[model samples]
Target: MGLWTVAAMTAGAVGAVALVPVALGAVGFTSAGIAAGSWAASMMSSAAAANGGGVAAGSLVAVLQSAGAAGISTATTAGLASAGAGVGAVAGRLIK
Candidate 1:
């Protein structure tokens, strides 16, 4: 009803809106990274094969897997942090 209440409500709304994008951005970024890693691995494997280097594609596979796990972990961390921020914002508005 007052200016302080209106400001708090607006901030809470902004925080809520931001939470979704923060999560979606993490997902989108991770997907792009995995796709790029897969593409690079494929290209490297082909190049090695062409050069008669008997490329061990398995190493690339391992690297890709590791990258994927790390991406997921990072996304999860970001998502949790975003959730915490959202909760804090709501709690702050409510308490005030």
Candidate 2:
């Protein structure tokens, strides 16, 4: 794809990802202004057992930490995509 096209796609993807929280909140699925990172990190630990099964504290912590890390990683990926798109556009222009 052309560099400008890639840039446009990257921007659109980032925008879509950024809207996730807003959409979730609008649907009453998530609390307003609460970061997804915090939610992911605490959700497992805060959840009550559905089947009367208790989760081990240590395991719960590990799961929550991993989920939080994943959420952060997703944001990082979007940022990197945006940066790369800018770089690609510059390089493409210079090559012409």
Candidate 3:
């Protein structure tokens, strides 16, 4: 409820939102593609296996792949921002 808490929450929220793309990229999810032998590739493999050798549409792996290949949609971005804000608020409270 204080100034510092609000600032911390804002910063945390912004940081979480910004870091998502970078984190995805770092784990081999990029505009290019899922890098071979990378974590993304592994996830794809597992998802495919779980779905009888095919990655089902709308699955987590599929969604992430889509986001990586293209970019996150507005809805997804909004969801991420909300999650980020929630985490930020928690962090702010804890820090205080």
Best by TM-score: 3
Please list the residue runs of candidate 2 whose C-alpha ends up more than 4 Å from where it truly belongs after superposition.
32-96
The lDDT of each candidate is 0.51, 0.50, 0.82
Error of 1 at 71 (Å): 20
- What TM-score would you give candidate 2 relative to the actual structure? 0.33
RMSD of each: 10.3, 9.0, 1.4
Q: lDDT tens string, model 1, 34-94? A: 3444454465557567768654556654444444445335565455556655665566667
What would the per-residue lDDT of candidate 2 be over residues 1-96, giving only the tens digit for each residue?
A: 676666665655566556544544443333322244555324433553532454455564444344333443665557656765665566555555
As for candidate 2, its clashing pairs are none
- Each model's TM-score? 0.28, 0.33, 0.87
Cα-based lDDT at residue 36, candidate 2: 44
Each candidate's number of clashing pairs is 0, 0, 0
Clashing pairs in 3: none
| Model 1: how far residue 58 lies from native, Å | 36
